[model samples]
Target chain A: MGNVREAVDSGTWSLPQWADQPPDPDLTGASFLLISYGDSEAEAVVQQWEAGLRRTDLDPPVLRFHASAFDRDQLADKLAEARCGVRLMIAGGQYDVLQAMATARALGLETGEITRYATAYEDLPLFCPHCQTTSRAYAEVFDWTDCTGCHRVLTIKPHYSSQRGSFLGVDTR
Target chain B: MTDQRRLRVTEVRSLCPEIRQITLEPLEGTALMGFQPGSHLILHAGEHRNAYSLTGDGIMPSRYTVSVLKRNDDGGSAWLHQHLAPGSEITAEGPVSMFAPVHNQQHALLVAGGIGITPVLSHASALAALQKSAEVIYAYKPHRAAHVDQLREICHSAGFRLTEVTSAGNCRKALRDRMSDQPVGSHAYVCGPMSMLESFLEIGAAAGWPEYRLHLERFEAPELDPGEEFALRVSGSPEDLRVPVGVSILETLESAGYSVPNMCRQGVCGQCQISVRSAGSLEHRDYVLTEEEKAAGGSLMVCVSRGTDVEVAL
Candidate 1:
């Protein structure tokens, strides 16, 4: 079910490459399409982007947000209308960002077409192999957490499956 | 370059006056690798090598099929046309998937011009097998249109729509309107003359399509103007080569008693990538590198691209 890789700078290969804040995207590349989650720092992230582009004749990026997470229906509607020179950026909880990425990918968005920013990794969605249960845990790669379903201690894997939208929690012992 | 295989021509058919469709299978008993839709094979005949788009399904293909446009040059097509009899053997390199369809792609806007329909045929087969509805716009002169009957049959069988245009103007006029009807996550692939490809790219870009969703294959282009002469300094070496206007960097490197691993000297093969340690300006004019790869400025294809006051790692 897995393969492997090496390690180097920028911390490690497994971690999603993003700063604590979403960096300013190259505005001239493509018109931005921002997807933010609920009333929080994410809303502020959206507002920060909106205010920065008042000068140019660039089309104001369309913002699609959900109260809790991303609304697939609305997201699909907006994306359907999107043309060639478009860039998509999604920001939310780590789990929700992964989910949104998977959904967008399913609709045909390639890595070059989309960008992601995780606002919170504290509530990382951990999927336990033994109990087959998914639970949120304050864990990092190689960290240990217990499954709520079968009560088995699991080690969070470095490998993140975008399709499953969760980090694998392997019970080594 | 190491994995070379010989394939025997199983069948050959004259698609039209200028084009011929040839089917090839393993010369000996061996399983050929399955290919993706829009894959191409670099066929070698004598001193010339050319890449031809496979006009069949990618799944564990028993025989590879390609439709070639006879340009009258010795680069495989003219040779293949000259030797069209069955049982003829030829060496081939790969079923390269550079211009393939994207995975999990919702809809495809396949635009082809003249001989560019070869890959689009493969894509149509793929979309049909998946039972996905797609659109195919083939632009060609009435006499030059290959695979029109086959395309019509595929359209009849599958849910695909086939629209034929006599000129590039008609296709360009129709492309914008057709793109709007696609669902989210759709990709538009254009394999044609440079003008058609440019128009599709322009339309897609103007309409807000991302670079990832817009795919194109350019086998031919108007002759590139000889760039300005520049002196290249090899990193950590005393060698300084003065590259003139008419010659490429690879030829210059060879002339200076240096050997670089390369093929398809015209820059299509991408076998001649070198580390661009530093440069004053890099003019990347190859089909291989992605936008990010070119922007990263680490390596560049030595064949077509040129740099000024550049220090390259030999």
Candidate 2:
């Protein structure tokens, strides 16, 4: 409910340097956990995160999951075991990271309790407003994406849906 | 003509020493319009207009029921309690919606304090009918816990959880624990005294609840803070109307011949929202707008929001 970092716009491609910094001291009181995709891009981001965490006294726990192997049930179990006072750091491709955020929300973690740093923008999770279906797209840049549900071309909107945990795609055609 | 319809009181019973439950039916012998859970009807008794939450079943409700807590020197409740008898006719405006359950929520946590339990009761009933999981925490004075037997029965039938915390109990700690245990996508609805509502909101937020997941319904109007006199410049109007120090923006606009649609004049309803063409030092007092909307200065609820001097697109 408190202020979470704003979604980085596609136009603002340069990531903030502070986003690479260790979790803020205010968040250090809780158990620090990191979730990252197993891809090379995400691995580089995790390395930075580990280096940042090592600079501090916190020995944070790290977990990596492949996009195909990310089991929501396992994540739910881990979240249940973490209980209260857990600060989570997430890094992955846009789609992978959004899936993790959705899981975190399902496990009762507020946006304020989780920090996200997008590692790769190659893939995006797009929600078709027409048929209310969400699918992934692989594109270097977001423009018009085809919806598998409605078979319509959708233009990705600048806005994101916190409820859907995905980028909203409006029917442009 | 007002939008009010005449209804006859079919039954009246004292729920507690200070609270009375009145049941009404349409005089035309037709089913009243279906209202969503947490909807309220405004009783128009002469010049006294007061909003009361409909406590009966929202789905195909046969009779509209409301519980009024009698207050000394309060003409509305006092007059209804003393003079209104069975078969007596009354005028009521609407089942306007200010609070309702968020759709597709995984679970619902309802918190009610004192007479604020009116709307919470309806929400619980609706959640039960929908077979959605719900937990209701009702905080009240130990001696003034009204309709406990009936509420327990309803919860039992609906498979919902009910926790009654008295004034002597540690209600805050209980509420905090419940909020902490709620799963993700769980929505919380609270209606109670201002202090209790504020406390629940703070506790829920601290326990990782998002703003969209939390709902509130305040039974009383917002307290107004004194502001300096200001002028309202209506678009296409020749004269700029002066809003006195104590007058609300809605009152000033109404006096200036603008029929601004409004309900829950306390600013809870978004009906009176008006686009602000330009403004100087706008003071926003409504609960409807988000922080970004308020900062953007594009619109405001004229019922409660004001400014030193502002130009509005009527």
| Candidate number of the best TM-score | 2
Candidate 2 per-residue C-alpha lDDT over B23-111 given as tens digits, one digit per residue, 9 for 90 to 100:
99998756688888998888875557778898865899788999988877666888788877899999997887778777666778888
Q: How many steric clashes does model 1 contain?
A: 9
Q: Which candidate is the best by lDDT?
A: 1
lDDT of each: 0.78, 0.75
Clashing pairs in 1: A83-B208, A83-B209, A84-B208, A84-B209, A84-B210, A85-B208, A85-B209, A86-B208, A107-B185
Q: Mind giving the per-residue lDDT tens digits that candidate 1 earns over B255-287?
A: 888788776677666778899988998988888
